[model samples]
Target chain A: MAGHSAGTEIERLIQLLSRLPGLGPRSARRAALQLLGKKETLMRPLADALQDAADHVLTCTTCGNLDTTDPCSICADGRRDKGVICVVEQVADLWALERAGANSGQYHVLGGTLSALDGVGPDDLNISGLVTRVSGSDVREVVLALNATVDGQATAHYITDQLEGSGANVSQVAHGVPVGGELDYLDDGTLAAAMKARRPF
Target chain B: MAGHSAGTEIERLIQLLSRLPGLGPRSARRAALQLLGKKETLMRPLADALQDAADHVLTCTTCGNLDTTDPCSICADGRRDKGVICVVEQVADLWALERAGANSGQYHVLGGTLSALDGVGPDDLNISGLVTRVSGSDVREVVLALNATVDGQATAHYITDQLEGSGANVSQVAHGVPVGGELDYLDDGTLAAAMKARRPF
Candidate 1:
């Protein structure tokens, strides 16, 4: 009689799942069902991966990004150009640019941008570390890929100001407006061409 | 001049992020970037919540739903009918049934169906527990709300077989196919009407 206690296992899964972003009690429950339905493929592996990551992953010492090791693979890569650094607000932006196959330069993750109203300051970002990175003798250009929002712009300015004495040529992603981004949701060609036609701010 | 070190944080984030469901390296980076752009609101809370949930949550014992408590709110509800158990393959199905707002009976999560190719057996499904639940007194009807997939059907039959001698009537959700679920993507009115005219399996 106690053998049919499916609810007990499910309860454990639901609790872990409900905590995911965009999932409330309802969606979390639904997701749990979906995961349970594919127990062999989805459930156990997900649990294992989560636990593994939680246990093994650590923030890169050189950068603020998450990593299983300290220096991170990219930072340890000697083949990459240490001279030019692409500054981005989040780690995702660096991947996007890489996917575009546009820039081969090294990268700096700012972690997040400067926001005055919400009380985020310079220390919260990776500004100081970035400034130190720019000081290395071989470094050259610094491309800024921060978003175009108010906070994004402010963060951009803060980075530019910090890089003043470093002598690195700073730039932002060109192409007026983004494709698939509102202005709204433009064509790739338009975005690409805009990047090609960017002017100084 | 050293300030920004590109590829440090971004690469680490991608490695960590690529592990999420529906996200490869590309999408994870995109999500991380989006979070960076909205750090104060979306980013911080998301991180805090994830950490909090990871640290605090445990599985519920009674209904198989996730909660901070063992029984979960639904299982603890004495007002719900213990006699009529609505069986579903996942937590999602249970939530969907709840969303439909008609069924007020207690729930039993199957966790998954019997899939031979995937090496899933009855012991894997938490089904044996359902048999025990039915044998207990006061049980009346058991509603099966499985999907219309081949595996779903096979699981339903298996469940019906288990309940054969339990003296309880068993039924499946009837009416239109799901709206977003597509036959393909039916209208709300059609879906609502389908529930009204659901037939016996």
Candidate 2:
């Protein structure tokens, strides 16, 4: 049906584009048409780029960050604090922390969190790999920078429990009202926590 | 900065995905991550699909519809009303009309409508090709199924002016409250048009 007016090739392209995160059927069709319109400037280059990424991109063997290298540029960089490992639920969270300039330490991507309701558990995550990395490295601290969500916190707790007496200090990121966030917009729990940890500012 | 963690290849891929019609930078990154997660099942196939589309999709020489062939399926189909050419601004429009079963005629895609502010003119569109198609063919009617937008009306007027002496009758699609649309929710213009063109049920 999709190929009735446009070709089968365009239909297939739209199908693939719809599989992408933000695009639906209409947007995918629009995108396909746009690409066809700008084939020389966009469509051919997009195909080449996707092929390049599929062929070259690899997950870091040490931290699980997606990159072009085995260990990744982050893991390969000796300047980072390798003795401190920052644990994150996903590569996006790790990137968020890195973007905020909050941590100069290496990261461990958990891929996902512990969610009992969703049938996810310790074995479902990268917890065993985290333990392996800690047991093999001279890490001074294992920082859990997971999300504030229940699953993220539960995963952090589970990781912390696993690393008990592993000859390294285990810690997690703080919880407080976000910077530039209005107090009225803050939830009761956040307000309570912010009050409990009130600063001199 | 995008290459800081995900590598230059991924950064470049995100850059191209963001160039798509509906995807922004953040969504593009998410899409890239999703593609990477399913490289074998999705990413590789998507790359091949895009390549195939870019390589094979061509505009129909007869109707300007995009297809795998020069004349396109609609133009070549012996069952369709080839004597009645339905003119639309884009292939999407052609498909929309086809989806609604509104027309079973050959199509002419203008690619885009005339917009003086946007620097688009009659010469910039497929007007001359349309003239040639009508002049050299047995076409009896030209249905302007263009959108009711300002530019769409302007373009329709231009095409009508050019086809003045042509034997083929020119007709714009009727305007009214859309089928299954409530009268209260309809725009004033649509209500008036519907009232003026009212018929016994």
Best by TM-score: 2
Docking quality (DockQ) of candidate 2: 0.75
All models: lDDT?
A: 0.66, 0.88
Candidate 2 residue-wise lDDT, B1-201, digit = tens: 354777888889989999998899888888888999999999999989888988899989888888889878888999999899999998888878877788888889887999989999888889899999998679999999999989999999999999988899999898998879999998898899889988889
Model 2 Cα lDDT, one tens digit per residue, A68-166: 999988999999998999999888787777778788888999989989899997888888888999986799999999888888888888898999878
TM-score per prediction, in order, is 0.58, 0.96
**CAPRI tier for the interface of model 1:** incorrect
lDDT digits (tens) for residues A1-201 of candidate 1: 001223434444445445444445655555554554444564444444444444455556675655556686667768877877888887656655666766677778888888889899999888899898888556789988888778988998888898897878998876477445674477776667677887888
Per-candidate interface DockQ score: 0.12, 0.75
How much is the lDDT of residue B184 in candidate 1?
Answer: 45
Poorest stretch of ten by lDDT in candidate 1 chain A: A1-10
